[model samples]
Target: MKFTRRLFLGLAALLLGVGATMAHAANALDTIKQRKKILVAVDIGGPPYGMIDEQARQVGSDVEAARLLAQDLGVTLQIVPVSGPNRVPFLLSRKADVVMASFSITEDRKKVIDFSEPYGVVPVVIGGPASAKVASFADLSGKTIAVTRGTTSDQELTRGSKGIPSVSIVRYEDDATTNTAVATGQQDYIAAPPSTILAVKKASPSRDIASKFAMKAYPYGIGVRKNEPELKAWLDGWVKTNLKNGKLDEIYKRYFGMSLPPEVLQ
Candidate 1:
C-alpha cells in the first residue's frame, strides 16, 4: 500500500510538471516591469548569507545580490524573509519573484524550479573546536554534531550517516543556533559551510574551530519559476555582468574579509 501510494503521488507530480511546462509561455519580465519591484525571498537566520545587521537592517551576500539585481533592473527591491520550507512555496505562489536565499543548485530542486547560473559557491564541511578530533565523516562515529534543520547541511549529513549508527545529528532551528551549539560546546561539531564557520569565529574569536572533512559543496543560484525563460535569461546575464565588473567581489569582501575565489565567480 505504501509503495502504491508513493507511485500515485509521483505520477501526479509528473503530470503537474508537464502541465506547468506546457503552460510556461507567460512573460515574467513583463510582470516585473509592471509591478515596479522585485520581491526577493531571503533566509536571514544564517549569518553572512543573510542576517539582521547592527542597524536592524537585513544584510548579507544573498541580500546584496538581490539589491544589485533590482538596481540593474531599475526596480525597487522588496525582501521577504523565507526559510527552506517556504522558499519554493512563496516563489511558486507569486509572493516572491525570485529567491536569493543561499539556495543551492541541485538536481532534485531543478525538478521544481529553474536556477540561474551559479553566482556563488559554499564549501561544505564539518568543523568544531580543535579538541573535537573529527578528521573525516567516518571520524564522527559517535560524535554529537549540530546541523540547521531543513538545510543542505542537514540533508547531506543525514544522507552521509546511513550506516553510522553512533553518529548523533543534533538539529537546530537556525544556522546561527546550530553553529552556536558547537562554539559553546553543546555539540562536538557542526555540519556547515566554511563561510558559516568563519562567521562563528567572529563571535568567539578565541575559539580554535577548524574544518574536519568537506562534504559536497553547494553552488548558490537565483531561483525562478521553471517556465520563466525571460527572467532566467536576464538573471544569467546579470550574473555574467557582475562577475565581469567585480560587484560580486565587492559584496563578498565586505563580509568575508577577502575577495571571492575564482571558482565561485560563475
Candidate 2:
C-alpha cells in the first residue's frame, strides 16, 4: 500500500512540473520581458505604413506604433521585415512576436490568427492614370489590374470583379511591385489602399494616377499568434489607451493626413 502511495505522489509531482513548464512556454509576454526585446514584423516596402525615409531610417506609422509598444513594454524593438503574403506565416512560425504592417482585420484572417483592436483604417481603391477608363468595374472590362498577392486588397478586388470576365488580374509579391506595375503603365489599374495609390502617383508623376473607385475601407490591426490570450489582451488595452490619449491619432495624421473614423475613436 505504501509503495502504491509513493508511486501516486511521484506521478502527481511530475504532472505538476510538466504543467508549469507548459504555462511558462505559452506566456509570450513574459518571454519578451525576459529577453528584453520584442520582434515586430513590418512591411518596409509599403510607404506610409512602413517605409525607409531619405535618411535611411525606417519611418512609418506601423514602425512608430511598434516602437511605442516596445517602449511601453520596457523592451527594445527589433523589426522583422515582411511582405503581405508572409505576415501570418511569420507570426505563426514564431519569426515575429507581433505584426503591424497595416494588417487589416478580416473574417478570413481571424480564423488563423488573433488581432488586437484596430489602430487605423485603410481605404482601398482601384486607381489608374487619368486617361484610363476605370470609373467602375464595368469600365475595367478590357483593362488589367495589379494587386499585391495575399493582401486584403487582392481579396476584395477578386470578390468585386467576379462577373468582369474580361478584366485581367495580375499578382505581385509586394506592394512596391504592385504599385510599380501601375505606375509604369505595365498595368492599366491597381487595386490598393489610397496611400499606396498615392505612392504610385509619386513614382510616375507624369501619369496623373488617381483612384477611380472606392473598394471599401478596412480597419488595421496588430496581429499576434493564436492562443496568445495574455499578449492579445495586453495589446487590446494598449490600443484603447493610445486611442483615448491622442497618440494613435497623432501617428495616423502624420502619415494619413486625416483623423481616424468616429466609430474607431469611440
TM-score of model number 2: 0.97
Q: In angstroms, how far off is 35's CA in candidate 2? A: 0.5
Worst lDDT run of 10 residues, candidate 1, spans: 21-30
Error of 2 at 67 (Å): 0.8
Q: lDDT by residue for model 1 over 114-219, one digit each (tens)? A: 9998888776788887676676678878778888887788888888877986999888877767878877778758888887787777777777777778888888
lDDT of 2 by residue, 1-266 (tens): 99999999999999999999999889999999999999999999998999998999999999999999999989999999999999999999999999999999999999999999999998889988777666777887877889999998899889989898798999999988887778788886889998988888888998788888998899989999988899999999999999999999999999989999998899
- The alpha-carbon lDDT assigned to residue 183 of candidate 2 equals 77
Runs of candidate 1 with Cα error greater than 4 angstroms are 1-25, 205-207, 264-266
Residue 62 of model 1 has an lDDT of 89
Question: For every model in order, what is the number of clashing pairs?
Answer: 0, 0
My TM-score estimates for the predictions, one after another, are: 0.84, 0.97
